[model samples]
Structures are given as structure tokens and as C-alpha cells.
Target: MRPSASVAALLLALIVPAAALAQAAPCDGGSVFEDRNGNGRRDAGEPGLQGQRVSDGERIVVSDAQGRYRLPLRDNRSQFLIKPAGYRLANRASGLPDYWLNVRLQAGPALKYGGMPVATSCRDYGLIPERRKAAGDLDVLVFADPQTKTATDVDYYRRDIVEPLLADRLAGRRVADLGLSLGDITHDDLSLYPKLNAVTASLEVPWLHAPGNHDLDFDATRDEDSLLSFRHVYGPDTFAWEEAQANFVVLDDVVYQPGSKADYIGGLRPDQFAFLESYLAGVSRQRLLVLAMHIPLFDAAPGRETFRRADRERLFGLLKDFPNLLVLSGHSHTQRHVFHDAASGWQGAKPLHEYNVGAACGAFWSGVKDAQGIPDTTMSDGTPNGYARLSVRADAGYGLRWFPARQSDSDKVANPYLRLYLPKVLRRGSYPSRGVFANVYMGREDSRVEYRLDDGDWKPMRRVEQPDPAVLAENARDDETERLRGYDRAATATPSAHLWNAPLPTDAAAGEHKVEVRVFDPWQGEQRMSASYRLLDTAQD
Candidate 1:
């Protein structure tokens, strides 16, 4: 479970996950898998990923206005192919795109899209303070690995995503004053940074970047040019910047500590650590210490170890004194939030909420064509490819709403895709593994939920009444699950989003199925979402 190119290439060379592949319809395109931001679901906005080319040997296509693309491969290819030169793929987590991907092809044509999350396009960085004692309302934009392997990838991000963000700024939204890229901005092309920054200049924001494995020189006779090219483009590797509300501390954790430059881990070297300490010396305790690293402090399922124990401990020690420390990281492009509950996390009392933001590239932008024939770049975890806007509220509360690329084109603030409703699960209690659990949010409590599994009978999930503590405490806690659970629930912005609990009758034969659930709200038409789960081997019959 790691996000590395070698692992991806190796997995592609070996196991093409059956779950991620599908059959095909002849030259109908060998099952092109692209980010179909159509239907206002996950399209790109100012920073759209346009002009990406997808081919499966027989078919070829490009991205469109919806930040979508399509392609068809001839023969028995199980997966729709990805063109690696100009544009690599993206890996998204909970709701943010990072550096991993999951793709499905049409019909029997199978394609295996695998890899560790790359800190290429989606990234992190410390904000360089522009003013002191100034208006405290500060908002920083975080872009993870875009992994522009070629000029096209850059163009895609420029047209599909960044340009829209610029438009948002023009619209008076107070777009983030500062910008930070996670890593892998350039895919081995040390020469791409200046041009990349040039396009990023569209936002009219001062930006900072981190180096990823792809951005490094794998084979250098000497270490002088380790990140020499990077320094030439974005300046020092590890440093601090200031915004009004938060004191940003960035660390270059991509130190190739073990193998020269070719093979390294997500680790920070002595010099980088020293820079962090030196930067912290001047930071005040009241100011939030936001550590933005290219690699995740934790991980997603396929996302493997990046930030190790020693580094976690070291970083924890560094920020332990500060009461407000926010860790913004990406690498595991699986959008999920892990709040350092008192039970699980690195250290300290305050919950360290780390986000495994999904990829803008959506599993390397791999998948079959949708109604528009563009790649359905929804990641394996089911998160659609998209960017995230993190607003650090003036009240010291962080407010985040992940905007699907498709949403920027429309004016509706909340769409059906953004709602979540789960059933009541016993608080602090475990349920029988085989029992059925329900999550329903049908706008109103009276709306119904219809469920079906692999030709199984349609089942009705009953709505039960119960007191929801999390729901009640949401708005009360700035850093509560409300800001974070959006990924798990897709929508339902308010605390009334999700309600989950298991029923006694949820047993089945040990097998797999397409469990599809559709909920209808009074305002919107019926909305459908699906999840696949294998019956636990130890499940009680």
C-alpha cells in the first residue's frame, strides 16, 4: 500500500485488479478511462485538466470542456490506456486528487492502473507571510501532484483547473492569497518548472513547490545537483512563509536517504530538518503551524508508507508546543480524513487531522467513457477527480468544501452528489459482521432508500430514530467531522448528512456483488451510488 512509480509499474506488469477493469465495445474505444467532469459531478473549474490524450493502441481521444476524455483500445486490452509522456495520471483520496489512480475499461478489455500516490500535481507548502498584524482572515490554496509529464499535462491543468481558479478570483471570492504545490510538478523534466509557474501566475498568487521522486535526478554522478534545478525554479527546499492566520512551515521530506537519487523514501534530511527548526524558532505559539509536505503523514489503502515513524515523531516533537498545528499533505490520492483522535495518531492532545486528498488526475485519468464517452476517472475508492478549496475561517475554524471540477461550471451551491445520509449505528458498539448497515440522506426523512446486490432482491433500509452526538456537536466544533465527513458522504454539508447503524439481518454467502443504492430527494431526481464489498471470510452464516 504505497504510492510509488515502481510499484505502479510493477503492479501494472503483474496484477491488473479485476475490480478496476471492465469489458469493451470494439473501436467504440478500447475502454477509455478519463475524468468525466460532466453532469456537474467532477468536472474541472479554473484548473481544468484539458487536452489529455488517451489511447488503447486502436483508439485515441482528448479531453474536452468538461475536463473529460475518451479512447478505445483494440484487441483484448483489459484497461483503457494512459499516455505517459505529456500527462501522467492522478491519484485522488477522500475528495482531493493526489498521485494514485483506479481505472476501468469497457467489456473484456482490461487495463491495470496502479501506483503509489505521486506528489506531482497535487502538493503542499508553507505560506510566505505577506503582511504582519494585518487582516487575520487568511486562506491558502493547496495543489497536490499534477505530475505534468509532458507539456500537455501542464496545458490540461492550466486550462481545466488553474484557469477556472483564476476566474473565481476575478469573481471576487477572495481566492487564496498564497498557493502551494505538493510535489511532482514536473515529471523528470527539470526544465518544466518555470513554464509551470508561468501558467500558475494566472492566479496572480505567489506559489511554492516541493520536489517529488519524479522531479529528482535519479542518476547524478555527484549530489551537487540533487534538487539544484528545483532551487533554481522555486528556491530553498524547506522553509517557512507567513499568512495572516497561520504560520506555514514546509519541509522537503523527499530526501533520497538510502539510494543515491534513483531510490529514496519520503524522509527529511538533516539540512531540511535544520531549516524547519530554524524557521520554527521565530514562529509564535498562537500562530498555527501548518506543515505541508508532498508525502502524506499517513496513507490510503493502496498508498504505502511515506512519512515513517521516526519522522512523525520528529515532526510531532517540533509542533507539540504549538496548540494549533494543521498538517496539509498529499501523496495518497485517496481522499479520506484521519483526525488524530485521542486513540490513533502521531501525538499530542489536539486532533491532527490529515487528509488523503484524492487526485485531480483521478487514477491517472483512467476509466471507461461515460454518457459523454470521457473517462470516468472516479478513483477506486469512489471519489470523483477534483480539487479542494481549504478556507481557514476568520474565527480560527477551518472550512473546506471539495469542489468537483464539474461544479465550477454551475451556480448551484449544493448538488445531490454532495449530500450524505446514513442510518443509526449503535454508538460505541460493534455490530455483527454480517448484519446490514444503512446510510441514508434523502433530503427529508420520509424519502425512501432502495438497495440491490448482484441480482439480489431489492431491500428497503428502514429509517430509525436516534440521537446523533456528532451531528449536534458539529457546528460547535470547528474541526469536527462536518468539515471532514463530506468525503465519506459526498454531500449533505450540514450535520444532518450521515446516519449509520447495522441491522441484525445482513448475512450473505461469501461473495462479491454490485450493491447499488438510490435515494430520491424532494427537490432533485433519484440519485444513485454503489459500493462493492466482499463478505468477510469469518462472517457468521
Candidate 2:
């Protein structure tokens, strides 16, 4: 990412404080205590609540002695903030927000937020990989960048998003799947993780964690410097597991790399790279690969509003091999779709799709207020605070749906296909000899779609009949055949009448007009999606 002049100047200022004064060093975590009633400082009875919790996004844990705690301790993105209870924070000197401990320890070590303290590896600490399988049919309550500066800010997450999804994430949604906070768990306070988790767990789903840059060791000098306390508590940062028709790989790529002044870098470590390669070797091509991380691959090239080209290119090079890759990332805080194509790869097929899940925090956790006076929580790119769902099939296909927090019914469809047609006019010369092409993958086969155009009334787009008689007879003879295997309802082996070649309304005029495609599933009850396009004049009209 290109460096911002303003940010560079600010760092320079931080490195060289305007007025230098020696400050008192508090306890293990720090001395940033809440006054509860906004008093001057901590006093008797208003003790800094002990045993508080903290998180980065992927991990969760309680505070330790001295009223401080580290979360998902081992994750590289472990930027911990104190989880303050019954209190809140104004902001930090970073101007980035509240105080967060950047674990990329290069700055040095700290009993507090000054820098990262080194320790023997987990092997040296007796920690090892615990062969664990995440719960089944798991409902994961994923919150991306819940960066809150004040308690009021936390309420927005608690009221608008979390409160509504509580029932679903706990039982109604996936039933057994757990919930996860993607990153930027809190604005800054390593202290905030606990208070946040306390409120989040009220939904009744166990929360996994991941750290974010905002949650990092701000005092770090080098990239390797990190919040060792996070590792000591949670497990390691990189890990894997299998579920339904997919295998999940959660990576910790937000490594604050070493730079001239002090900036964060994104990358995969040598050990993590090895770990991923090993995980990939055993997975079958038939299964879907879901790679979840905080940063997006090149920010999906979302105009110039994304990450640096070099970073994206580097990330793409690292993980473009798999046949079935579905990346779920959310760094830019916007919902974006990125596509990558490799001439030749192991699985051998079409290019890959990377989806950048907007944000649960939305726009660094700032925006307009809702009825509850909480900011609207809209993401920087105008997407609402929401989560995504992927329904996997017995076969190699999956259906994705995005749900906006403000809606009751699933009627909100965010990713409607953008329909593009070739040749404004269907001239006799260009018309396909086979008629026309119609792809019926309107999200799902069972979806009910009604269509209309400049003057024609709304009519349904039906899923017509399947195989030819001869082929059906042939398949009846053999229980297992390639043709039979590919002829399932979702997979059409042979084609017939085309949907794209609907007669261009013989009664229609030749002026510019509109063609509307309305799609919905009565079965889903509400979440119907629609798309519209312009129609050019018909040469022969």
C-alpha cells in the first residue's frame, strides 16, 4: 500500500513528541483505568475491575492478575486491548482510536503497551496442537472490525447487529456452528476485548478469534515483535479443520512488517506457509476450499479504493493453486468480489473467486445513528453491517446469501448477477443457429424468477424438463454412468430450448427501453432479488 503523507507526518510526530514528560508505568496490562463516573482517576472501591477479558477478532480470553489479559494469545494479528467493564474510553494518542497492543513485537517488550515482550516458543512453553474439531452445523457470528471507541459505540453492535442475530447464531441459524469475531475486535483498548466478548457471548455461541492491525502492538519496532501474552493464552494463530462439504483455513496474514518509519505489513510466515501447503495436499478437489482471513487479496481490485497492487499480487501468487478456492476476507471493510485466473493449475478449470466480506464494524465502526441513537453502522463502501451464509450441497456446489442486519425477512439480496448482453440488436446474421443460450443458475434451481420487458407482462422463468428419451433409456440400463451422474437436477447433462432467445417482442417499438428480470423464491418467503438492463433498438423492428 502506498504510504500516506499525512500518516507519515503523524508517525514522525509520535516518534518525536512535542512535549516530553516521564509517565508512570502501571501494571502488567497497563494503568488505563476507567473512572466509572468520570472522576479524575482510580480510587478505592472503583478498583480497575480484575480478571477482564480481551480479543483481536479470532480469539477470546479473560484478563489476568493486575486487571489485564491477552486473547487468542498465539495469533500473529493479536492486537489486544483491555476489555473495560461498566466503563469506556475517549481515544488514544495514536489518533487511530483507543490503545491496542500490536503484537508484531519489533518495537520491544512490554509488561504493558510500550512494546512486545519475547518468550520461548510454545514448544518451549509446553503448548501443542490440540486435535480439535469445531462443533457441527456451527453457526458462526462473524463481526468484522467492531472498532468501538466508547461504550455507546459497543451498543450499536449489541443492539442493531448482535441482539437480532443472537437467537439465530445461538440456535436458529446453524444450530451447532460457533461464532467468530473477524478482527479489529475492539477499537484499541486491549481492555475492551473482555467487555466486548462478555456482551457477545450473551448470544450463547462460543467465540473464536483473530487479531487485526488495529489490535496490534503499537510500540513494536520490528515486524516480529508481538503481544506474546496472546500466544500464551489462546492457541497458535494459524490452524485448520474440516466441516460439511468444505475445509476451513483461517490464516493470520496481518504481519506488521518492518518499514522506514513504522508501518504494518501483511504476509504469511515461513512456518504458516508450510502449514497451509501441508493442509492443501490432503484435501480433495471435489470439496470446497474456504480461506478466511482479515485481509483481502489485492482488495479485490475495488478500484483505487483498495490495497496496493504489489500486496494483492503477492497474496495472489501465494494461494492461487487450489481447484476449488473460495476466499472469505474483510480488510477493506467493504463487500467486494475479486476474480483471479491462472492459465493452468492443479484442479484445472475456471478462474478463482475471492469474496471480501464487508464489515460487522462497518467503516472503522463509524457512521450515522439508528433509532437507538447508535450510528447506522454502515461500512465505508456503503454496505450495511451484516453477515454472510453459504449453503453447501451434497455435490460440489454452494449457494451464498448475504443478510442485512436491519431486515427481518431474508428478502435482502446484495449480490444480484449483473446481466450483460452482446449485440444490442439480434440481427438475422448474428442469431445463434442453436437458437439462444440461457443459464438457469439464478442463485438456485428452486428459485422462482418472474421476468418482464418494455411492454410485455410479467411471466415466470421455469425450469424445463431434462434428458432426451434415448439418453434416459440408456442411463436406465447403467446404474453408474458419466451421463447419468452429471444429469442430476442441478447438473444438466443435455440441453434443449434456450431461455436467452425469447422472441424480442414482435410488437415492440425500436426506441431505447428497459428489460427487467425479477427473481425470487416463494419458498424463502421474502428474500427475492431483481436486476434490470437497457435494451437497444432492434435493427429489424
Candidate 3:
């Protein structure tokens, strides 16, 4: 029907304001409904989960009896159901862990690299009923930086890493309880997200993923939009869940900014800090606090700040109230245990332990192929490409053990718990610049490492910071090999954090001698390992 201009002006005034109000409607919080049938979706009969806390990365609110809650959201954000002690969020058919919902009022500009495909409004979560177990005393497998770049690399991860973990049932522990991927789950190739999820699903466990620098959306113009794809795939980048008698806080510490190219720095967003402080305020100080992220909270090397000091200091301040704390990170492919205490600005009474675990994609899947066609991706720190098993006690005490990618019957018997390195050949009774080296993979500062010469008395091995000779040799092999050995050579060898050295015994005759090394790990079980060293009387030669 046609209308006069005066009548049309009145209609426009009425309709325009109504439409704008609808657009501004609140959706900051959503329902956490119960899916009794385990279908992973909210159906008609499903009831709402009440009294649970949900956060939108800034403020937290408790779900009412009807399971409805509201958050103060000013813009696009993610809201997650902090899996309470007695419940768990449902898993997706895509195999990716799903716990949160993205709340977007409207779509942003179309990105050159394609940001989130569509804006989501109602962020509802569905969960299957399950009784919560005390996660206080549990074993968890942590895989750092699988970083599968290509589809082929995904296959490599499936066959080489996932298959073994499944075959072993994560070293005979419960796989469904807890497992974590420190970060860098994919190598920039977001398409492989499904493949990685499928591989992780085989463990049949609840896995938490933290987004790394490579997981950011490169085309996003602002730092806040950098993780659109990641959130789209893995839910909230900053969320906390309590289980295993501890609080597991997963954060997206990678800050991406576009420059001549896309560059990233390690720091936490201001909002995330506020979210952390708010969430922790309600948490009991008795529980163990485990902070899991991609980039470490402190620098890996001296004078080189891998993380922002101001942000780290801020985080440290927030953690001051918690006495039981542990930090787990995986960015550097190498593995080492770092202690953050007063010297590092950590205000906790006890020094905080940060485990910079090794990568599952050792050396980025580099090195020569083996009989199974798997690349021998030994880490630059001389730690083999593998994973770690964290043993958490009900009281929050914990210990860690590193598992090499490959293990054989002989290896299981010889050095099942440690690694010993020694020179293959040495001149008898002559000046030896480099001596026997032992890489007690799990040794710490207070560890006792001693060596004995073929039934001789045990002698202590001095701890030294140096590049592992074996790792150096592995790199040299790729460099000197005439044939192409791998997609890329191992990263230039770096000084290992746990290396012990001792001078070869000159009393031994010019013959083949076995140098046996025994180590007493402060945390792991005792280990005994040996390697044969040849002494050639240079004068006779």
C-alpha cells in the first residue's frame, strides 16, 4: 500500500528505533543445558545446568535455577562454562573440545584471509551427565606443539605420535580423565584442525588446547580479532576448568599484530587478566593452580625476554595468593624446567615451576627417516621428540616424566628412565678436550649424576651447560649427508638444560671400555645407563 510522505515519515520513525533496539539486545550470557541422551546438543526435554559459573573473559556470573545468566559484554566475546567439579562439557562430532560459545552481535568486515565465517548470537552449551572424580590424584599426558603444518604432516602425527600413544593407552593410565596440548596444535594450516582433533580423540580423554602464535588469524586488523578462527574451532581462548582436585587455567597468551608481515608477541590481554583475577577470587586457595599456556611467562634465555615483563609481573601479582602453583608451557621446541621465584618476580612463597616441555613434532618433523619412515625429530636441547606424563597427587604435589618417541625392549631395559651420552672414540691417556657426557633427560639442579668405569668406583659427573654432542651430531648428519635426509634439518643445536660431563679415566688400558652412568633423579626413579668408548693409543696408530 502506498502512503503519503507525512504518513511515511511517521512510520519510519516508529520502525527504525524498534529495529535498532532489537539489534542492541543483550546476549552476553547463555544457558548451560543438560543433554541427558549424550547427543551433544540441547533438545526440548534437556534441562538447564544451574549454579555453575560462566565467564565472558571479563566478568563471571552464576547460572540460575533455569540455567540462564547474563554477562556484561560490550563487544564480540567468548563465554565458557567453567566445567564444575561434578560435570563436564559435551564433546563435538568434529572431535574438537567444545566448552564455550562465541557471542557476536554482528559480523565484522570480511577479512582478506577469512576470519570467523559468521557471527554467533546465542551461545548455548550442552552437557552429558557424569559423576566427577577427584582429579587431584591423576596422570595426564602433555604434548607440546604438534604444529602440523600440512595435511601430510597431520598424517605423520597420526601414524608416528598418535598411534603410539593409543597403542600404549597413554602409558597405561586413564586417557579420558585429563590430557593437555601445551599449544601450537597446528602449523598455521587451520584446515588440519579436524585431523589433529581426531588424533587426540583416540586417547578417549578430555583434552584442553591453548592457542599458539601460529594459531592466530593473520588477516585480522586488530589484536582482539587475531583468534577468531581459533575460538571458532576450539571455543574460548581464555577459560578455566576445575578437575583432578586442581584448577586448570588455559589462556591465549599470544598477541598478534600485523606489520610488514604478521608478527606476534607473548603477553596476556588486559581483559584476560581481569578475568583471571575475578575467577581466582572465588576459587579456594587449597586447590593446586596449574597455569597452562603456549609461550612461557618468562624469558627462556638470559637478557632475552620471551614474554613481556609487565604482563608477567601482573600475572605474578594475581598468583601471589595461591601457594600451590605450577606453570606449563610449550613454544620453544626444546624442553627444560624453569623455576620462577623472587629473582624472577614471582611472589609465591615457593618458587613456581614452569615446565617448557618438548614438542611432539620434534625438530618440526625434521631429521633422517627411520625404517618406519618417521623422521627422527630430536629436539635442539637433545631431548627426544616425545611427551610428558604429569603425576598429580590429591594434595596437589606433582612430578613429571619424559617419554621418548621410540622405545624398544633393549632400551626399556638399558636406560628405561634416562639417557647417557659418550664419545665413540678417544685417544688412550692423551689430552681429551671433550669427555664423556650424560644427558639425564629428567635430572634437575639437585640431582645426583655419577659415572663408573667398568666395575670401578662410582665418580660424580659435573653438571655443565653445553650443547649435547649427540644433538650436534644429529644436526651435522643432515648438513653433511649427500642425499636429502629430511624436509628440514634439525634446528641448530642449542645448549641443553640438563647435561653432565666427566673426564674419561686415563687409568684404563688402550682397549674398548664401557662407561656406565648412574643418576639419581630428584623426582623420577633411579636410572643406570652405559655406552662404550674406544681408546686408540695414538702412538701405536
Instruction: Provide TM-scores for the models.
Output: 0.53, 0.53, 0.89
Report how far residue 15 has shifted in candidate 1, in Å.
62
For model 2, residues 28-102, the per-residue Cα lDDT tens digits are: 434334445433345555544444434443343454444444332232344333322123333222212132443
Candidate 3 regions exceeding 4 Å error are 1-24, 42-47, 72-74, 132-136, 168-173, 260-262, 408-416, 536-541
In order, how many clashes per candidate?
111, 56, 4
Output candidate 1 Cα RMSD: 22.3
lDDT of 1 by residue, 53-166 (tens): 333222335556543544432222212222222222232221221221122222221112111111112111111112234455555677776666667656666765577677
Ranking by TM-score: 3, 2, 1
- Candidate 3 Cα lDDT to native: 0.79
Worst 10 residues of 3 by lDDT: 407-416
Error of 2 at 99 (Å): 27
Worst 10 residues of 1 by lDDT: 118-127
Highest-TM-score candidate: 3
